[model samples]
Target: MKSTFLILSSKRYNYYFRRFSFDFQNKVIKTKNLFLFLTLLVLSVSVNAQQNQVQQDSTKTEKLDEVLVKAVRVDADSPITHSNVSKEQLAKRNLGQDIPILLNYLPSVVTTSDAGAGIGYTGIRVRGTDATRVNVTINGIPYNDPESQGTFWVNLGDFASSTESLQLQRGVGTSTNGSGAFGASLNLLTDAFSENASAEISNSFGSYNTRKHTIKLSTGLLNNHFEISGRFSKIDSDGYIDRAFTDLKSYFLQGIYKDENTLIKALTFGNYERTYQAWFGLTAEELQENRRQNPYTYENETDNYWQDHYQLHWNERLNSNWSTNLGLNYTKGKGYFEQYKPEESAADFANLIEEDSDVIVRRWLDNNFYVINANVVYKKNTLEVISGISYNTYSGDHFGEVIWGSDLAPNTNIRDRYYEGDATKNDFSVFSKATFKLLEKVTGFVDIQGRFVEYKTNGVNSDLVDFVTDANFNFFNPKVGFTYKPSSSNNYYLSYARANREPNRDDFKAGVTENETLNDIELGWRFYKNKVSVNTNLYYMFYQNQLVLTGELDDVGSPIRATSGKSYRLGLEIDANIQFSKVFNTSTNVALSSNKNQDFNATINGEVVDLGNTNISFSPNLVIGNSLNFNPLENLQVSFLSKYVGEQYMGNIDNEASKLERYFLNDLNINYEIKPNGIFKSIVLSGLVNNIFNKEYVSNGYFGSFDYDDTSSPTGTTTGYYSGYYPQATTNFLVGATLKF
Candidate 1:
């Protein structure tokens, strides 16, 4: 009877294979080889298993979903310095802020918001490294933008509500898909299918007229095989800065199918955001007068964008020793940021008119990205190996149009494009990772990857200059590490990794043609007892041709970068959690670092000056965070969180005028739950008070220098510095309630 059932299943699989082939041939031919290979392997394995008649275990499929991220995530005993955050922990702070703001208290992290509040356009930096160098993945699939290599949290407003878990690996921890991790890697797993049907409604209101509304539902397991879950969220904020407002809408939907040995999921998530411009931060004089002031006065100056994503994942448990995962993704993004230029030169706008004129123009980007990932895992008594291949392609169109202008040229329409450009990129990589027990209490790990990238662009840039580029690069990254567990409560580890990365679109435009490289070494210790856990690590990172920020902003508010010949960072990080008693606990982390640019030279005071071993820009030397929690009642909890960041420079030159002062901030959070036997299962009420002391501070800023002819100087020219600061809100409050049924 088992043989007969196998034969019938084979026939059904063949029919599905035919349909899959048809779709592959027309839609995703570029990645057909790996897809075909995996499919054939699955078929061959199934047919050969008929002779053995292995009984399927339905319980195994419930845990198969974890395989989606098994290839990229690390365990506590692994030779990696990392932290994991669960959905339950995030719920306490799931206000209208972006993901970066919610993760602000993590070890060695700094967060900034452009709207003077945490409601819109937030960014995160790890180990003093910017977001561009921090790789991000969703369920092991790449999430960073291909062209910019940056993660835009504003695009996924209220995404924390849909996340099941997230892990942050500091330093070049492992080899994964998409861009390389020069500083850190973050991967998130979406909500898992629930076992029981449920519905939830959450609403929150905060300062600055901020509010959020969310609706979520889960169909649970239907007939023990199928499940569906979804969420919709809307967020609005009248920001703390003048004229800075945000309106955002986002949704997430997923369908899952599970069986005795297989788990397949299809997901779609996206968001649309309209945010008023606040990137032009205030100068020192303006900040002293009114810290919430915005330099831009145009009423219509705003950024509007919409992005959509589709993902399909299949995980198969081919017995206990072998498994495979295949993932496919498609992302569509389109957007435009409108700007008002006063007295702009015609040459800059493609000679649309022969003279200077005030114009309102829009810059647009339309892009499509596709990815295919496949991996196979083998696990035995004391050995495990994972090998994977990933391929992605991106095509983007860039153009700009003048929507209104004081003067017009002949035969030009209102939406005539002033500049147009297009770009295409293809990235392919293959990697293999293995871990095995070498001794009674020692384990070893090795990871190797080869990556190839091809980038091409054509047409004119926004500066009305003919821009063209065709570049190709190949990189080899290798990592090795070992873990020693002396006892059940103590572990020690050491690791070394090497990574290489190419420049982004802006870097190419700035005449940067060299790739960057990093050599990182890490040593760590971990301890776990009945009521205490501690993790500490030391890291040394050396870089060549590193793309360091130049402390300048382009016309569109994007930061500019220039390559530094040599640089290094040395840091020590320690984090611990202590449960003093049943009702009280504490969590704290501290980071101390020294970041420097060796033999740095800059053009200062009309001469090239060597600033020997200067401090790296925006790299603070000391950062500390702490959380004190109390649970006096069964259903009530209160947490007091605090953070302190030391002073740092905004420019590599170490000029006194470019310094940003140190700041200490504190927040209070409270959560209470009511279990009712009425219509609702439970009601959760939460309140958050930020900057409880009403402290005024600035968290981020920019500085630059320029040389100009000066009659008073001894030389023919002199250099002057200019700076801008982004101020944080003094005091703010957010309160919310959630109903679950």
Candidate 2:
């Protein structure tokens, strides 16, 4: 068996190697320093557990840490549609890709990458809703940008390594911090403090000149009450697209103190990233000519950004029935994306110069965010109640500077501000939720929240126009649900929830956007027996004044949205896991949905046309994912994964040119572990082959329409459609090894 496995692996490698070209020298040189850094860091932190005092049971600390997120998480029996992912599951494919890409196989999920290889600038959409509407929290603290309401995974490269577990709650699952969840709410729990001293070094190399190096260490529990753990990671990738490259460095450190019923943690994590711009995708002609071509040719066309996050958490268990948690966070972010404009009008750049000339400019965002959260949980025999209050304040400065130009006005100098603006926002919310057993076979759930928000901005925007806004909103959200379990193997649930969200900064700039509201209803069933488990969920979501995507991108590559008077999404999602035998198992999920904008109206050919009952932009009708796993040996595992996305339109007008074709993809993954008796305890090796069939596909794009008038035509005017597409890589592979001591 061993010989056969070896032969198969060799043949597969030979086949792929023959079809691809590798710059071995360049890759080796680029990763040499990373290897050295990992070795030094691991050696310095390596320590023997026998030298330190024995600690309390690690399970106690783990339980206390779990308490930190209890207020925002739901259990399997709850009336919610959610999925939980563990570190073990994530580790199987944690090779250089972003978290969204790693989570691509989940239910109702769609992920895209601008760099084509999932190493930089990734985005995720759930149930036809974009990232801006998806609420994200790290250890129960809001992680989305307060102004844009978007989550930038590039700023936290390789964060999956530090995550112990995560949960994705679809369709306004529960009350959480930050913006309301119109699509989904995701919460991540950081790694728990280890009870024994340990250290690990990991390295991976893949296609497209991609490589990752990570070093992790834990001091274990010192004197039975304290521990220190940290991780440092570096990732580099030359993407499939021309001149698309990413260089990222990140660090995570935490100091923990814990006892039988108390836990205190202080942590800091941050990343510095520099990546060549690739957001401008290909046009139709360009896609057919050379899909990998990039239009931007400037040498320094890049984005440089750094963000640091600080958090402190305290959890105390007063008694069996009462517990409390307090969390504080301070985040500082500063970054800028540089661009070179040719033959640009000087008046468009704050009148910095008198005439149209080629220029180089840098747009910067410097921001500070502060958050305070307090929550308490009470539990008895048949009832559990959680109440929490969160307050956050954000202040950000937006400015642009002209670095160089062919021509300049008198008194104008280098590094002068072209346009400047500032914005501040304050958000406060209080929520109370309870779950209680009402009868022998029934459980009831209720949640209520009150949120208040104030946003203010003043100054000139990049277009040299006065962009000032002062908006305030008050919202009340409520949720009710119930679960019925007639037998241990069967469970049924029904729920209804309401959510309201204020417009983001871009919304205000686009036009007078109103607050959006959602009413969601969910029905679900769970069946588990023996080695098989299945979950089915049906959901209906109705929106009022919803900000739907217009399939257009701003100058900075951000998606543009417009208010839809009324919209609805109805879907059925089913996910299952079945163990057919001791060595073989399978997991599958499918989502079938119908998303539409009622009585949609648009300006076509210089006329307001009522395009009644049109499909919502970027909302696909079918999505399916499946995984087949086989454990040939006790320490070896191999899996095959598949994904299919149905065709979807990119515009509300439903024009043929705005449609994205459906595509299917397959991947192969292998993992093996070896135990040794020497200095290292274990060595693990992993390999992944993505898009195994080498299928060409585009996962995301944009669409727009322009009207032109012609005297020879009867109507005298015509509408033209233009679109851009982001093509994904055909086939790629990543292989990695990890050493634990």
lDDT of 2 at 356: 77
Model 2, runs deviating above 4 Å: 1-62, 713-715
Mind giving the per-residue lDDT tens digits that candidate 2 earns over 1-741? Answer: 423632553354334323322222232222343233323322221221112213432212126888878878998899989999999999999988999999999999999999999988999999999999999999999999999999999998999999999999999999999899998999999998899999999999999999999999999999999999999999999998988999999999999999988999999999999999999899999999999998889999999999999999999998776788999999999999999998888788766766778899999999999999888776655566677778888999999999998987788999899999999998877676777665568887877776778888999998788999988887878898999999999999999999999999999998855799999999999999999999999999999998999999999999999999999999999999999998999999999999999999998776789999989999999999999999989999999999999999998888999999999999999999999999999999999999999999999999998878877655788888899999999999999999999
Candidate 2 backbone collisions, by pair: none
RMSD of each: 7.2, 15.5
TM-score for each of the candidates? 0.92, 0.91
Estimate the TM-score for candidate 1: 0.92
Clashing pairs in 1: none
Task: Per model, state how many residue pairs clash.
Answer: 0, 0
Off by over 4 Å in 1: 1-62
The model with the greatest lDDT is 2
* Distance from true location, Cα of 454 in model 1, Å: 0.8
- Candidate 2 lDDT at 633 equals 95
